[model samples]
Target chain A: TKISQPWKTTITTDESVTPWEDATQYNNFYEFGFGKSDPAKYADRLKTEPWSIEISGEVSKPGTLHLEDLVAPNQLEERIYRFRCVEAWSMVVPWLGFSLADLLKRFEPTADARFVQFETLFDPKQFPAQKSSSFPWPYMEGLRIDEAMNPLAFMAVGMYGKVLPNQNGAPIRLVVPWKYGFKSIKSIVKIRLVKEMPKTTWNMLQASEYGFYANVNPEVDHPRWSQKTERRLPSSLFTPNRIPTLKFNGYEEQVAYLYKDMDLRKFY
Target chain B: MLKSRWVKALLHIALLLPLLEECWQIWLLVNGMPNRLGPDPGKVILEDLATVAIWLLLLGLAITPAKQIFRINDLMRFRRMVGLYAFTYALLHLLSYLAFILGWDFSALWEDIIKRPYIIVGTLSLVILAALAATSYKAAMRFLGKRWKKLHQLVYPAVLLAILHEWWQAKEAFNEPLLHLVIASALLGYRLVLFFNKAFSGIKNQQSLRQTARKNS
Candidate 1:
């Protein structure tokens, strides 16, 4: 994986004061354990030292890159955005990183780069949950070439001010705030640039519901469920059942251009 | 060779029908295509339904210990049915997640289970439930012998995983998870006490036999 050069900035948030912790520590990754507290509990065992990402497919240069090399060259920036999950929950976080568009441009996606596929590191010995067929582990995620290069998408190295906690896709992860939470693939190890749209794990498992473009728009109803409202984690039961989802997660000015002339209702 | 009228009646209505009903409901949730159940209700209801199934299964798992600790032996009969109900509901839960949550996108499902901690944990609990359900039959028990007990022990971890799955998603309050945690703990604790009690009795019996032999000599 080829990461671009330095674009430094003054650290906006406190790196020492625990950066910006997620308003809620509990995460959707329940394989390690099931409590809202489970990831925080068991994530400590995840070894971030000596992490490496296996880069493959369609790229002229295909190889693995160490985590140190990936973050070493890049400068961090704080971009606060709203993260809306498909489960109808939402959160606001100040994520630290640079644009994914900048990073992908360095790799020089070829004319054949129609879509970019990402694979999470799947080692059952390390991540025991991978062994269970209940889910095909080393979970995969993908983006159309244009989506991958969207300016809002961040190839994040840190969140808050400091390095990412292991529970929150430590080392590096993709943060597509406007899209559904699942679009933000974490703890990535492989990047495969491909001609055809790669089968994202969830999309392949059930194509009708999870489309290739899992944009977080209120208008698009997942055939069996609604995307109109979100729960906002840490909210009380009386805190209203539905909060109208925004288009482009409130970043329409920047990203709406990418979808011009395209039917969002059909494409979404 | 002999069949009791009550047992036969129970084997059909009490046991068989609920199983059938549970499967039918899951089929409705999973196999039925769009518009069969009206418009998509949205994510909250799906989450609610999944949590309900998880709790119901935990309740079913608790029946055996509940009966033993409370000395309500009759409750034992309901354990299998309740557990099956949990799996039945879990199957629906899994389907909803695949259909509604992931939009039946296997790729997205794969990415989530790998990349997201909550999805990974929730899926783990479902897998455990699947394993338990697959082996619930008498034929499996007869085939495995002593290993059957060990395999069934997975129910404990599975229940714990289920609680965690529900807790993480609940997000709103700790009250529900805490309550379910307490119930599951008590049920598990009863098993520990039973094990020690049985072990202690066996040791006392051995000692008494040794003393009797020495006196006779």
Candidate 2:
């Protein structure tokens, strides 16, 4: 199960790394519950083992693949990426995974595959929040074919050099560094390639608040709150260590070209 | 119950418990202890204080009805303390939000109050609570006389506004706010029934007095 580390240089940042305990404990995994600490408290019920992802739509090899066989071929890498939540709190996570492109390529996506959609485990028995009508139960997220194929788009199976804790998306999850943390669907049970842009859970719930391409843009704000600044997690008591949110979460140099001529405000 | 100093002291402690608990948690958080406030401790504290403030407001409003129904005159003595505590919590909630969420940025706070509907409603409720707290003393009560009662009537609308503020701020889980709304509605509904009953009895008494005068003539 020990795959060779493909990446040597850890993604460095000016900000201090968030404590692993804080990062794992404070999360917005609504499948557990609405509260921030709900995931850490209730995610233990999740059965991460004996999991498989169904690959369908626009793929040459459309079939079910066990979690182990799916990740066996690719080498895992340690990526210390900035994780910006839509709620204006941020964390730097040291994730271990292979590039999502590598996994998608193995399935032999057809030319018609313009989008790659991901879906989280939908069983109400494991996820208690599924019973609540707050949001659509099975969390779904999507990325353009080129975006999914990007080097920064990762399929994280572990974090802090250990197998992902149930709260932190155990088994396998997508980690798109440039977008908000919610786009990185956790406990993924399905990945479908399609010609049209897929409807994401948040966007479907409230299109005005959440958009399809949830790129971390400072100019564009969430309908409820401003996203211009972010409070770094584990901030001090008196002063919140707030920093200006970067465009595309500081990956503008790499991913800005993807939306060259398109208006980010409209797509946001 | 009001004659007993020990009973009064116990009621005071019980009323202050929520604020004291929040302060203790904040103290732990400030000292780098793993506190219950969670990651965004300031935000959590702000919300907790606001929620407790509204609960205290409702409890204060419930005192009169409870006293009337149960025939407990001593309940009125605790109503002022509860109302003052509600005001204190509301002040703390606003200060916490301004200091923590807005980072002491007055312009941003002002903008929020002006632009955000929830903030506007919350601020209005706080303003009304402040006025009620200010006029709560005997000296102010004497100076205002008849106007004091009318001014204090604003508490009803303030409670309604506070409930609406909480409801508007709710993003996903509305059960908590909805429960508060139901409780507020029931309290107000009880008051309405009492007012109409009093009005009906007053009319009947007037008619009886007229009939007594005719018999005397």
Using lDDT, give the best candidate's number.
Answer: 2
Q: Candidate 2: misplaced stretches above 4 Å? A: A1-10, B1-3, B107-117, B196-217
DockQ of each: 0.03, 0.45
* Candidate 2: pairs in clash: none
Off by over 4 Å in 1: A1-24, A30-36, A240-242, B1-217
Clashes per model (N, Cα, C within 3 A)? 46, 0
State the weakest 10-residue window (summed lDDT) of model 1 chain B: B33-42
lDDT tens digits, residues B1-217, model 2?
Answer: 4668888899889878988999999899888787898778888888899888989989988998898899998888888889999999999998998788778877766656554678888888999999999999999999999999999989999999999998877655678888888988888899999999999999999999999999999
Q: How well is candidate 1 docked (DockQ)?
A: 0.03
What is candidate 2's CAPRI-style docking category based on DockQ?
acceptable
lDDT per residue for candidate 2 within A1-268, as digits (tens), equals 3434454544656766788888889988889988889999997899988999999999898999899999889776788899998888899988888899999998899999999999999988999999887677789999999999998999998887778888988889999989998899999999999999998998888788788999998888776667788888876656777788999999999899899999998999
What CA RMSD would candidate 2 show? 3.1
> How far does residue A207 in candidate 1 sit from its true spot (Å)?
1.1
